[model samples]
Target: MKPVITVREYARLTTDKITEPTLDLAQVSVSAFDWLCKLNATFSNAGAALVQLENRCLLKLDNYVGVLETPCGTRLEILPKHFEREDCIKQSRVLLRRMIQVSLDLPTREVGAADLQNFDAPLSEWVMGRFLLALDHLIKRGLRFDYQRVEEEQRFLRGQLDGVKQMRQPPGRQHHFQIRHDIYLPDRPENRLLKFALDEVCKATKDAGNWRLAHELRRVLLEVPRSRNVQQDFNQWSSERLMAHYVPVKPWCELIIKQKIPLAVAGEWHGMSLLFPMEKLFERYVAASLDKDLLQDARLKTQAHTEYLCQHKGKNFFQLRPDLMVLHQNKSWVLDTKWKRLNSSGEDKSYGLKQSDFYQLFAYGHKYLAGEGELVLVYPRRSAFDAPLQVFEFAPELKLWVLPFDMERGVLLGAPEGFPLHSQQLQSSEQSA
Candidate 1:
């Protein structure tokens, strides 16, 4: 049976995340340690550090205070991945939610420089991460730069023709300069990888402190600029230009601030990272889909999420506005979005499930039951084509599938809850890596 874990417990375990990072200086059984590392378990990658003397180690595990260890004479550089650990993934999620909310609460007027710093930076980072993913997705699918404007430059080579009218160099205000390196998009992977690679390049670049990120990239190749984190600064610096090209994210913000629910804007509000790069389990993931549904039915797709409620509540009162609910062929089913984790064996995760979750679904089943009222818990997956999907039966003829949203790291894997794979599925790195 899959272990059931609670969201409350996950938060409790996450409080000490990033607080402890350790290095161990001790003599331990090398074979024992190696075995752990092989399981994607935490082990000292730098085991040789503690060969002779004790060293300082940062312990990041939950409720565990920092410790100094000298096992024997060898040193160990170990990191923990377990129930209690400071994970970057968790931190990113929390920051993203808060930043989105904060941005929504601000006045509709142009968010000022102060606003950009106080709120936009964090939100900008989240958007940037999403943008990075989108850019990655399109690039992998053979997308290129939108449009490039190039002009022919005929170089005036010296001595091309004997006695060609010689013109003396006149010193004047230099209005323009030409770039040397031919700027052309590389092949697919290279183009898709450029953003991520550029991020790394910007970090190491001596003039990174001088780099900026306005709507368009402008290079001051003539005189290199200083370096610092300037992506947001660039965006704001070129706000005038940006406004001319890109519409403000107002309607989207109003839904969250005024409505507390960020709705879709022209069906482009919610961008799917899906399995192409990550999971689309958040309520925001369906913003675009909801907008379309609402447009068609005029009243449908309006559901509960903090300040709102869906169709009806059951006797047990487990409230849930499913990711999607539609009446089809005189019947309706509730589709719920779920993010999943795995164990070393690549099987369904029982670790993160909470008992309350089952009850909530039970309520949905009771209230939304039609025929064998269907309820699907959707998850992001690699290649569903490689493995057989495991299903659980809630009742006789009543099925609930913990299905996969088949999206590759960059390509569209499949669809929501639609496992587009055969029974012979291959295990993923979620277990072995």
Candidate 2:
């Protein structure tokens, strides 16, 4: 049986030959391992492995499960656990789907029962499955292939020959006349890249012993031309062209173009492992959720950039980009999401809230919220810090709220649970507005 180990970011694990042994990664997974190493993961000299998941990557691995396949056909499953098992997995799925939509710039779709059925499946399988479904849909609508002009020399005339060029080259001594003709072809860079990605996913599915998914991917790959030198040629296409022609596959294509995921190559194993910064994800989730649930007439802006923190020699520097800014009735509320776990025992010490964070929010409070409005620091609700602590007295006018954003509930708890100031101030601000 394959060994399953649970870990989190910066978690270290020593290989025990007796109980759990070190993995001899398969070529494909080795390539995936290389990708991880490029990120924050490290392998020790003592056959131990350490995965230091940064905010971005942890966000990317929504399910927080990584499957490493070995050359010996054995598998090592690494599940990063930070919260309760079920809650963590559920949260991961939600984040993963959101990340996919954001990366693709696609609209968020409701998660159906069918999608949740595969909640326990490997993340790669789900991603590839979604990709395949999209690809298949595009194929049904007729794969977008452009009529690219090709110019080549041939002994025999193929199309309308270039008389000027033919004259310059003259007739070959062995073959006779050489002709250059412009021929329209379907084998373009965009198509090739898509084909390459499909093939890569297919191989990964096969390696995972997921024949069902592999079969579907193979069927789709059959329709696309076997792309060669895709990595070298993929960058030539512009985003505009991709959106216009390859609308269905545009997101996946962008994933490859941006190197957010891995491109498959023949003779070498390659896979994609995505990571998301928890800070950004938390901020986005809060901003989006608040916009939908909390504010009615107010405008919500994320990473709202309005002013520079300071000016030097007539030069503006240090731009103030608040995570979430809510504007209502001529008043702005600046809220920043922090992914740190608050400790109740350290209440005297700001509940493990860094002094720098407080200073940062102070700047936001003064500059963006005009000192009188609510300046909030949001954190995930933990058992220790389930409720919002007392508001910080940054100044007489400015108030700093330490609130808990309930991950499981997907809402900002109020008062003793969260920050009471949030709802109260918003209501007061709205009544005045």
Ten-residue region with minimum lDDT total, candidate 2: 21-30
**Which candidate number would show the highest TM-score if scored against the true structure?**
2
Please report, in order, the local distance difference test score of every candidate based on alpha carbons. 0.32, 0.56
**lDDT, model 1, position 355:** 62
1-433 in candidate 2: lDDT tens per residue?
Answer: 4323333433333322224322221112333334544432333333333344334323122222344444334333434333644335445555445534543354223335455544565455556655666666666665555654556665676767766665677444435344444544546666677777776676655434444655665675564576677556566655674446455565665453335432111112333434444455566667666766654566777788887889999998999898887667676678888877788766557578898888899888878766776787888887888887887888788888888877654567652212233565665567699
* Count of backbone clashes, every candidate in sequence: 44, 12
The residue ranges of model 2 lying beyond 4 angstroms of the native Cα positions read 1-6, 17-82, 85-114, 152-159, 166-184, 206-245, 256-258, 261-271, 291-297, 304-320, 343-349, 383-387, 415-433
10 residues in a row with least lDDT, candidate 1: 269-278
Where model 1 places Cα greater than 4 Å from the true spot, the runs are 1-281, 286-318, 343-355, 382-388, 407-433
C-alpha RMSD (angstroms) for model 2: 7.4
Candidate 1 local accuracy as lDDT?
0.32
